[model samples]
Target: MPPSADPSVSVTLAEIARIAGVGRAAVSNWRRRHDSFPAPVGGTDTSPQFALSQVEEWLRRQGKLDEVGGRERLWPEFEALGDRDAMGMAIAVTGARLGTAEAGHAGHAAGLLSETAPARLGTADAAVGIPVGISLSDAQRALVERAVSLARKQGAYETFDFLLGRWLDTHVRQIGVTPPPLADLMAEVAELSRDGEAGDVGTVLDPACGTGGLLLAAARRWAGSGSARTPLKILGQDIDPTQAALAAMRILLAGHLPERGDASWEVDVQAGNTLRADPHPGIRADVVLCNPPFNERDWGYEELATDTRWTYGLPPRTESELAWIQHALSRLSPGGTAVLLLPPGVASRRAGRRIRAALLRAGVLRAVVALPPGAAPPHSVALHLWVLRAPSGDGTELGRPVLLIDAADVRTEPSGGTQKTGRAAIDWPLLRKIVVSAVQTGGNGGNLPVGHVSVPLIELLDDEVDLTPARHVPKTTISTDLSLRRSWTRFGTLLHELRDLTATLSALELSTEEPAGQGTVTVGDLVRAGALTLRAGQQPADGAVRTGDAPTDSVPVLTVSDVLAGCGPSSWLPAYEVSAGEAAGTLTVTVPEEVVVVGAYRAFGAWVDTDAPTVLGPQLFVLRVDPTLLDPWFLAGCLRAPANARRAGTHTSTSSRIDVRRLQVLQVSLEEQRRYGETFRQLTAFERSLREAGAVGRELVDGLTNGLSAGRLPRDRR
Candidate 1:
């Protein structure tokens, strides 16, 4: 229990449950049973909130304060800031103060200042003041000090990362955090610029630098081989001063943008609206990276309509993304490159077609890469990355074909138990390699991987310069004869397997008498008795850079989809390693003998017997059983029963959520459990065989029909 400072801040019941290390139901029980519990301070009747100070007092009296961390304790004050925007500003202010304090400790005067911050600090230098008009109370200021101390104890980079993540988590709806994979991909793709290859990307700029993630990524890329020759100059601007300050702090802490006194580093980060106010007007950079606000309806359309930056054409109000594209283009030095993350709609939006056509004809639009959904925030919508380079005076690479990469099918790490948070994990390193290779090869469409293609400039410069990668990229088409042959072979094998499984299923007999019931227990009970353990899988918090040091691409992640479909491993792999000293909640499976349950979907459980080491993905739960007391297969079979699923499930129109702890299990002797396990296994084999046969039968029909229609296989003329 840290000292209670603010009683004004309030928290939701869910947050209270999270802090207490108990289920939400437990918190509800407390409020209902205890008359002295804090009354509802805010929120609806369905989800009442409580004052943080009162809740802390209550928890302390109940001896539950020890369960919450100091970081967790600070969340109520943030939430108490009243609105999402205010919370964001508060976070930024705290981050700036933290940066300044770190700098002061290092004995520097200017010490990492954001343009938004007050030029001079008062005696209480560590105190953070939000620019969003909400002043922090004395108690709140003390809370910030404690957070800074914790952050300082951890490395500066680590502390900023933690704070940034928590901030994003607190306000995920109002803002978006670019997943590390996508950010890295953008940085790598930007690095394909001529200057980048020559190891002389001297300047980097991000107009819409959200927490400075893209800029930091660029900084890492520019510092080639960890010994970059050119001293990098970085510039960034954001609409929110708080976020801008946080971004400045993050970059400064990473040491990419050193303090003002440092000789090699030159950094200028301003807090103002990028679209409305040109913070770095007329400044050209070697490389530009931006993930601008998407579908901005009020992006100074009328005012900027005649601005000189609109070289292609006056962008329609509906096409603010195009405005950003042109803005990046205008900021580029001749032959300099810029990579911008845009929505898929921008490529073919009717309003932006003219601008797209113009850019394509001018040879400034180099490539369009389609990324899978969950590549970044707004996870459901697939996004596109446009790589552009300013035309040289001689126009050497102008007429070259544009590269189109359809990487929407790139693999992602499996969510251990559930698909809970963050974007769908991507094989970032592999995707980066694929995008870079395609760009360098002049979009040749030569020996390119499965989902990439290179199309001629003339082809793309048609009536509408539609640059949708999937539309241009060639789809793999096989000869009808070959398709039929493969389908027939697969069908034949499945039929044979089905026959054997049918016989085996028929031969297995159930005992006429029921085994004596040993007892009944809940999942929590078993866990308490040390007969089983429950573990949830890991996911990187919003904007997190790998849970630990392990690279996200190398680790295998078992996702909920894999468990439901009984597939091997999902394509997603976390950048972090399972064996690394990872932060808690980092999803990795170190144990094999466990039942992986899909807590959010239809399928509830499966016994994972695979040999590959895998991390558990989100929305998943793993139950590890003690072999001496319980049969793993039997427990899995019991959990899979429809009755158990029905009991645990809280169904809705679109999906269902299961609370595994509430599901009941029939306890029996280990030998009896084995008998049931064998029976269940045989039945499961029968079900799988039927499914395989059905799938193969459908494929066989489709292939035969297609083959006959295409005249690739002979058809009887009877």
Candidate 2:
């Protein structure tokens, strides 16, 4: 537990959580509960602490060696993993084993060392089951029990998340993504710091800091560079307390100090929402790196219509992304650079063109670097990085030259990532080198001779005022029917992947009907269970509505954009908030949503967990379960199954958008119900690794099309 003098080796509790795959409480528990837990033998408590060997030994004793086991195994195995999923699995497994041992459960831990099912978790689809206190079809009930028993044997039976088994998130796809590369953040930071005075406040900040990924990289690079990153100030803030705390812990564990430390180099993480209440509202930094929430709609548009941060244009009611852009711009001091990760639409989309024009006319726009898809949390789409400078007049730097990057043609790895993350992570090194070269070119961060044209800022004022990178960047060739060609190719693969996943879901849903089955009863019969609760939504003061068949002008509908901005029409909401007063003038209001649904999920018939005040739509059926008889979290694991999605489609009530009553008709035993939850818990972790893999894959494909030997994969059929 001793701190490291190397500085590069020192880390804190939060950072350990990110690297170790455990919560801070778990780390604290290890420090407090285990007498032999590595104690900081030397170095200041505020500095990089812990002996690597000691920590490793401790992890080993706890059965947390993670797969190949031992320090000697960490690198070779990590390097051998030829796929991104495999790499993430390895990292997670290592983190888990390290954690399992710390929790004194190492003996019960299993590893996720590879993508092949057996290489990680057992290679079998788990059984179907119902949520606690809810009934299930006879077949599903039996399956649930079987899974529960198996999961108990594995020993991890209480941590299920919905995204694991789902092939793709309907929500993520519907919302889309403009994956900004972590490399872009690094490249921009590096660009700003090139040849700058030492100890000249080399810092990076993120308003909506998620996991502190960008911050960690900057910190690590600084820490490792001897004293080049002097007094490295890395700061991050978020609206969600959990995310902020998580980021804080993560930053500390990266061998740096948290906000509690005296050194300005100490972590500067804050707990409240950044946008609504800027904690360091007046503090401008040398470099600003951020990937704010994307295309938010109804983002409290009415409330902050007159905020000062709206330097560009009044972002339309449906344009939260633009607000973030301007907000980021406001944070930069003159000569300070801001690199923002944006979605593709933000660049060329018609609606926000004027605001884009205004920003460009101001000469703040530096270089627009294009990135392949699958870079950030919502990793299914392409993204861009906009590098803007605070109009520095150091006498030489910003009068006429601005780099316009056309990186869509860069070479990529076969598995869809840049070269830096090895197997399938973002190629931060490649992109960084490219961008740094393109922007600051001849300076210390030498720019590569890119085929960029220095068009006058006035050119951006042409009728379209379009900022799309593709517009200015030349294409080597063109297929007249690009869309048609995409359709022709992806037509089959998309259909196949879709059909296969659907079949899997259907198979999971098939009921074993036998004389109405034993323990089966209608939802009305189980009204006494009280395991499900309904939160039926009400009509908004000026609500717009829509059904799947027709696209109604239903108040722009409940899009992901709305939800990310805190006002979307759905059962689930973003895990964040932007508190007022603590922030600068610009603040957004959360809009009330319309409609709600009663129990209509899988195993659990409608009417569940509705005690909290909420706004739900018919798409979400409410189910109230008996806590005494069932664990709601466990039951929810089963209810969110693919099989359930299919079953709900048919068994659910047709009126008012599917209610929960249809689910209880299927008989299920409480014993088996618990099993489904256990099984889900067993697989929940794989979600991150799986998605990371998919993200790498998506980026690889995009990068390849722009330049690759794999030929080309088809586009998604809309």
Candidate 3:
């Protein structure tokens, strides 16, 4: 076990990399090459822990800490707190001290010396405060003092935001804070929907606010608007007290920032289950923005059965998102607008049909916009933005039509030409334009755009009040003749390419007679001979991998699916040392050039990756070969053979896993291997062309059939 003393706390390999200001791979190399490196004190073999004191001493003796900053050195200690909740509280406490210091409170600036419990700041003042009744451990106190000292050198807001950003990055999955782009988009949509006569949104509320992302977005939006001088009150509630405190501090710091300009903003974030207990129930806001928790089953259903907030109807027990929706609607004042980011299912789930009908009939729900996949959390599914308005108590708003905009197809093309897999990036600017324009003009008797539809209220009151935008938005089409011509042209080009590839493959001659003295060797022999190194991919560390298009600062991850499809990495993880260094948990990242093999049943394949550094995902094996000893392409080809697959496959009722080391390879000279590798490369290209041709052929047939059925094509003159 690691020592319990404060100075001898345990640290992971990842934390050591952070302290040394180097990549995890470097630390891994050090461990293997250096005799003086600290030994594991705890944790499992895969993620071994080392004593902090010994590691620090080793690093200092090696002169590795010379360029490391104080903040960087303190971070590992902060992370050592172990408990995420406690770490968050420590960060919040640090922010509070910085705020008090900025406010000229010397007593509070003494850094947690006084025993006075921290108080939650009221909404009336702009003071940043910590969570009430939370006490720091001795370890946390020492870390906070170091943090405060750093804060004094760097501005308080900058230091606090830096810590908070790092915390959010590490705990991304748990926190699920709204992406800044999505938050800004929501704020813009709300701003567009507001009534000009309301004299600017005086107040905003995020009932399910995680870390005040939406609130801050609103503040930035309104600060730049005509209402820049207006006082905006921000109210928020969360189940986690630490998150609530952090949210409050974040907003308070934003208010004091010089760039935010003398805008007066008040914020109060209460901690509790917003559904079970109503903290600000009596106060309605001019604007409400939320990215509520989705599909929660235990969201105070029985206790709030008769709650008056469900003006449309009591939400179904299974449809907790509906409850949040109704809560958002209830919190809207007369003519107030609310923009909610909800899963697409909430718009069309059967259980919420009645509530959907009620909202439509009462003209509360205004519009539903379908965002592209990867726009926000739960990124695999396309989420929706439901724009709603509180009834003004007049009948004039009752008969208005509901606008539906489907921007799900609006996505930026993948960055690299070779990247054929992975979620397409959401074209936020285009999405914003399409959605905002549609919302602003759809209800004003304007002709709906191609992806926009304006449906009457009575039309949605049918047996199923499905509000999914895809079901209602009309599909775009080209003129039949033009479409047919384009399809034919594409088909012809694909066929020409396929024909050339087939001819080239057919011209390749092979000896049908088998050699009597053929030599075969297993992959294990190559590794034993020091000709190759095999590393099995590991499950990435928690919160390491991100789904969707690769960001500029991220490295692509090669998954089993990507291997099977013979495509580039379908997912990516941030490449910054913070996350990337720990991406593969205990395994170092895949070597720059290697042959990657998938090991799943019926999905086994191998490919040579010559691209930039890529992280190997789980259930895969990376083979780094010595160029002089083995040809990577030749080895990949041999491993991908069907006969070799069966020979190495361990079959079960469910799956057939390939034992890569047991796979057989032909013993051949390097020159002969190069020749075989070239042939294999051509074969792979031929297969790809065949698949492309088949797809184009299908499109051609479908177009011709549709054109004929629609009587848009002339009959052939025989």
Candidate 4:
């Protein structure tokens, strides 16, 4: 016996059994078979215990463990294993359950256990289509059927392993991924099956079987060893070849095919569009579950204007939503049931009104369930699940209740990127509880199966059947005004800061003064005095001029307005940056309001000097004026402040920046311009400093604070 397996050193058989969730008999059987299993050091023979590791090791070496990649695949086998059954019995039980489900219900339950098909499903075309009448090789068919049957037979334990193998074989990548885990699918299926109508399961079908996600769930519910009707003969198809392959693998796991072995399920997967081709052609099933893509265009409308799928009415060229709805209807056998996903807009959008009306008049619109947004995404718009039936063929119909379910009321934001899986991106336990309850209680436009209030049909019709969840998730007493709350916090902080800043400002007597006062010196005069150097001419680098490499620094690259008036931030500032590698001798214009100016010369903006930094095309010039006499910000603001910006542009040369000579003529009162300009200049300067300082300083301080808290850094300061 291995040292780790010495019973006294580790957990005993009783503890191990409890931990592994198995009974004493199962633990006893393991010790008898494996010689390496250890007995307790001092315990008596009759009360002797074995190490837990012994059983764990034996299970691993014996290959009792599975490598199924997903929870859905492993669930069936897990459930069966927990029941203390052998592999063959587990497979049989699971298959029997799936096969025994009410007609179309198997498809949905099966889908839960399998992968899903493409969101945009249809009769295969060239995008994925091969010639129609073409059939699969006999061997392929057998392989596919066997996979289907095995998938049907697989209990919770083997489901993961089977699904992993199937997923790899199928080459699937999830898009528009769903929420809620696989466990929820099983629970929901079980919940639904419990409400079964005595003995009336007709046939089963999934129009859109991505990987038979829903079908497997339904299959497990009905096919398991129970007091139910015969196992449902499974049928599934997908437009995507890969999805078809996956579906086949799931079915094979369920023990579906005969004699042919590995070649079983290939016949189940046809390579054609389900929508346009309808490969099943004339077949009908008792139940249809589909998660068809929403609002897609390009379904070859022009070619099939008079197609039979348009039974309700002509589908608008722009609306694929209506076409899919009608298509699902056309395939359902009379008295069959179907539950499908749809964008909530389909129920209320004007473009789909005619189709909605037709479905309504036909009485096939069984219920409109309003689900939480992101039920399936790309959009957070509330979605709807349409529960439908083809008015029971033999007059066995019940009430015409819509069962409009508004499940959005129960959701919370995800934290740490941990999204809830399936339908609504909410917690599974909660989602399962709500979904099962809704299914059972039939609340909010549902027939109460148990303990929940039922909304009347008249109530649904009241507000144009607005199946939005907000209308239903009853209002609570605590109404939180998120926006208002934020505003209050902001105002409180602002008020506190204002009081502190007022005290500080009172201490500094910063005076605004004209450099030359009422006896002012001109910007041109200052530039000429050699206090400032103009940016020299430079061509754009021969190759592509990346925005990052464009220059700045040495010469204050002033735009046209800066040359004419001054500078500041403005729309026409040249955003493409260049290094100040070499100081240019000419005035350089730039997009930045203070650093450079845009010439509103021709029509919009411009600069004057030809030798300065200029726009590549036309209507711009850079003026690198000395910042000695006039502040860059003050000058720029004076020039571009709406009225002044327009005024500066009026003095422009044709097809170029505003003429510096014409601008120089316009007298800007050193007193008035500086009066407002100084305060603006200080604010702009302070703002720039704040931005340049950025969060790095604050982050460093935060790190120091954290380090001090952790006793790594001292908090002492002078």
lDDT of each: 0.68, 0.47, 0.76, 0.44
Model 2: per-residue lDDT, tens digit, 1-718? Answer: 1112222233344434433566767887878888988777443332224555466667768865443222222222222333333332333332222222322332433332121222222111101110112122343333223323322333221111111111012122222222234643554454554445323545667777754666765665553332433556677786644344334434443331233233324456665656667887887777777778876775667877888888888888767778888888788777777777887778777778899787776767766767644455344355777777665655444344345666554433333212211223345566666666655552223334233445566677776777766678554333213433543454455455555544544455545766464554434445655644433333322312221111110112232223234322322222111111002212111222111233333222222232232333323433445656555545555444454545545444433223344443334566765665454444443333344445545654564566444444566799
Count of backbone collisions within predicted model 3: 0
Scored by Cα lDDT, where does model 2 land? 0.47
Higher-lDDT candidate of 1 and 3: 3
lDDT of 3 by residue, 1-718 (tens): 1212466577777778877888889999999999999998866554577888788789888988644445555666777787888888888878777766664542323233122475654333353333467777888887777788888786788878988987886676577878898899898888777755434677889998998899989877765333545567778888888898889878876766778765667666788889888688898888999999988989988989999988878898999998988898888898889999999989888999998988888888889999888888877689999999889988767988998887787776565532534346776777777777786676442442337788987778889898998898764443334545765787788778878888888998788999667699999999999999998877666766666654454567777777667555766665443232543356445545589888886678887876646777778888989999999989999999988888888875337788999999999899999999998887877777787677768877886787677666666899
| Reference-based lDDT, residue 324, model 1 | 91
Q: Candidate 3: list runs displaced more than 4 Å.
A: 1-74, 105-118, 122-131, 223-230, 416-421, 443-450, 477-507, 512-517, 524-546, 549-589, 611-620, 624-628, 646-662, 685-718
Per-residue accuracy of model 4 over 1-718 as CA lDDT, tens digit each: 1213122233444444544455668768877886765555433343343444454565557654233312332222222222211222223233322432311232422221211122211111101111222133333333334434444444422543453442332121232323324323432433352236514443456666665666555454434322333334445666765455445444444443233222211114354567677777686765666677667788768877989878879888777877777777677776666667777777776666667666655656755656555445433466666766666555444434445555554444333222111122344465556556665655552432112234444454543554444454442212122323433555455455545545554567765874452343344554576633433333443431221111121122322343333222111112212211122212233333333334454333322222232333233434544444444545555444444444445444455344332233123544655665666554444443443334334544554465456565545797
As a whole number from 0 to 100, the lDDT of residue 263 in candidate 1 is 29
- Top candidate, metric lDDT: 3
Provide the clash count, candidate 1. 24
- Give the Cα RMSD of candidate 3: 5.8
Worst 10 residues of 2 by lDDT: 122-131
TM-score of each: 0.63, 0.42, 0.81, 0.43
**Model 1, 478-505: lDDT tens per residue?**
3334445766787788788878877777
Q: Which candidate is the best by TM-score?
A: 3
